[model samples]
Target: MTAEKEPHLSVARTATSPSAVQVVDLFCGVGGLTRGLEDSGINVVAGLDSDADCEYAYSVNNDARFVHANLLETSSDEIESMWSAGAVRVLVGCAPCQPYSKYSRGTSKEDPSAPVLRFAKYVDDLRPAVVSMENVPAVSRHPAFNGFLETLASAGYHISWETLPASGFGVPQTRKRLVLMASRLAPIALPASNVAKAKTVRQAIGRLVPISAGEANKVDPTHRASALSAVNLERIRNSRPGGTWRDWPDDLRAACHKGESGATFPAVYGRMEWDVPAPTVTTQFFGYGNGRFGHPVQDRAISLREGALLQTFPQDYKFEKAETLRSFALVGRHIGNAVPVALAKQIGNAINSHLEKYI
Candidate 1:
């Protein structure tokens, strides 16, 4: 985190009419954080991201402006301009977590220009009243994350951070993430998980009309599965819920599975158990062999809508692009990359509660 000079602007001069809390979601992909905060009664002014593919989904699904601008190129002054004059300004973001993902172990390090570092620029320049960020757990160990916290601390921000399991907050998926919250107004912290038992795969998507492999639901196109090869189709049919490739018959087992090294990847080519929360939904979740994404009873990988539901997006949540192509590759990435709405809502609730004292 390099030192960047704060923009020479008076808060009073730039202030506009205030109603409640106003937020600017940086690196806001498809407006997941915006939607969750909005559901908690916060006013989100806009979403800023570099991907044009996200424009329609962000604008259509949430009542906020979606600006397709790269964060590294966009200055903090331009960003602070979106803040409401009188409202409590909240800056929230979830930088792309690929750099810090466990899967990147052997891969080359993330580029220096990754969004994770760029978002810190806004924090240094604007110094909003409240800030929230979410990222992969691996990030907490990175020097960049430590530098980010140091920047916040030096700026007089009080911060609280935790590695939380999304399932603890009723996300219906065993997705774990690092959530950080900071405030200049007063001391703030995340709320305790209110959900006692984790939501199950069946509880989340049982109501949806079931579909088979390579078929699309007539009512909702997003409720569609990817076409599987004949061999993969047979593999899935022979697979039992919660069981792995170990269950496959000798003839059906892949050559890799017979090797000693195959034991290392036990979760692959497995079906999710109906009574348990799903494994973390990833960008390739639409593929049957990607993690344990297979439908518990249905002989297919979970549908796009089911994947989104596991992420806790609303049933009617609009993905403008899904209407036409219904391309599994495209829609899967959209749904998988999203933050769980339920978990985000809880974070919003914590922020709202933390601010009530100053309000």
Candidate 2:
């Protein structure tokens, strides 16, 4: 999957030039949202993230400055330093969602600090002209999340929010995320679903240059899966596409599969269907036993490039240099956690419509 080069624009003296507005990405893991916004003519000036892995990808890929600091600890004065005078500011945040995700249901809410609450504090302090947040749909229902929205409302922002399916916006994955946009200028809405027919797994990765287990593609090395342990290989071979451990032979079942509690969660240790969009790609997509992460047609797990493509990233999106396998993991996590690029582009287009009215 080759990346189509971005169109270069020459300097021009105009009121509506790309440089007129500056976007600050918060919790900007690998700059997925920033890339989409930049593609839509937004000037992405700075990206803030605590993860060291984000530095190279955000800086090199987006050509934006990367600030390595905890978002919860950063002060408004610190944020202001990243902006130029007289530039329209846009605040984009996708706070860490693990605490509020369905995966964390067993965790207690009384846990000392919450990152989402801290993120709202930054919004209150900065009060940028535009604010956009994306997270799991469950976050919208959380009391902490509701309070964040109220804070924005009290600050005079007209807000609109919804839980959107990524497939609706042309991502070839069945991922649903919550998106919010607020502005003092006027009301804002998310972009309407563009893909009636969801993109299938085959459409997304079937044409990729094939590679054997543990072998990277010759043209694009990133499109490669990790080597599987002998036990894991046998486990995957026993799993059927769209089927789970229940479909496995009794002799091959894991010890957990023999228990009653494990019987209830059947989506794990499964393969994806070639005709349908993939199940949500997670950070552990390179592991066959992680969720329904096995490739639809291939015998191994989906490769790094396949995971990015499923997340709506262009084929040639740069990952960290080879020495940093950990950076690759971080990049994969950020990509998996991102609001699909296709969806972000639609959100950008919606904001553009509002901008047109003001301009």
Candidate 3:
């Protein structure tokens, strides 16, 4: 779809003032990173993304200009124009990571280096004071990633990187991602995880108004649940929380499961446990067959809002307008792809703390 630009807020422009720590988020999908930075009291001047679908969410949720431009096409001059000349500049880039995701290992052979290379090019061109990027854990092992680090180090940036579990950062999901931070100002480090006891699935969505399979909560469209077939519902009814499809009776088992290869993939057709953090939320989290997305007690897969909440998005974070379609596939992808707001907030706080040392 052709990307449409969202309306601009005057306050978003004010962030470019000389005194604020101005940030320009690259590939800023739906403003999850921007919102987290804002929560940490940073001044984000703008966000840029090629996806037209992200415009409304980014603009509505954070005080940042949403530029509907692809990173590959946007020039250093164009990005520089968005910030003041004297402000402490930071660039946040979390490139799309499917190429490096664990699930993509065997089936997908895509290289997926374009976005990473584009981000590195932007850093080389802009030479922002601070740079932050997050991706799948596998990215840390890639040769290109090592090359990117070398480039940053050559530019005199004190870099720190680590792979952290989202549960450790208070996200009610077990997602793990590689995070890297580099700063020319001084040595900077990633924030230590805060979730002493990881938040549980029940804690994240216990109070939302319940919805049955295929039912939409009239009060909140995002709370709509995906429908289940009669047989699927019966399977879920028999399945135990945290148990795999192996819990199913022989009659309800998939034909594939009865086959020789079925034992290899056991996470599917499972229900989330109430007391533990959920499995990593994926692009198809609304489907029961996708990961362990079924609700602890509810007879349906978790709702769209539930999925968002699990990703640590604020309860009121806006994704689309009330009149929007709120399609399961679209919303599901948006929620799943987002970097957890809480984890991003920790990154922001770490950067802010590091900056404080120099300021």
Measured over all alpha carbons after superposition, the RMSD of each candidate to the real structure, in angstroms, is 5.6, 4.6, 3.1
What order do you get sorting by TM-score, best first? 3, 1, 2
Worst 10 residues of 2 by lDDT: 4-13
Model 1: lDDT of residue 212: 88
Model 1, position 167: C-alpha lDDT score:
89
lDDT of 3 by residue, 31-66 (tens): 778888888888888888888788877877777778
What C-alpha lDDT, on a 0 to 100 scale, does residue 209 get in candidate 3? 84
| lDDT scores of the candidates, listed in order | 0.82, 0.76, 0.84
Candidate 2 stretches greater than 4 Å from native: 1-19, 104-113, 323-328
Model 1 lDDT per residue over 1-359, tens place: 01212222212223455536788898888777888988888778778887777776787778777777877788887887887667788999998777677643245464733676677768878888999999889998888898889889988999999999998988998889999999998889885799999999999999999798988877787888888898889999999998998888888888888898988888889999989899998888989987788899988999888988999989887664544664677677777777789988998899889887776
Expressed as tens digits, the lDDT of each residue in 1-359 for candidate 2 is 12322222111122354436777888888878888887777777777888876666676677556778876667888887666766677888788887767644346655423667777787788888788888888887688888888889998889988998989988888888898898877787677898879999998888897776687776676787877787777878887788888877788788888999888878877889989999887777777766888877677888888898888887777775554354446656766776577777777777677766764
- Superior candidate under lDDT, 1 versus 3: 3
Clashing pairs in 1: 16-85
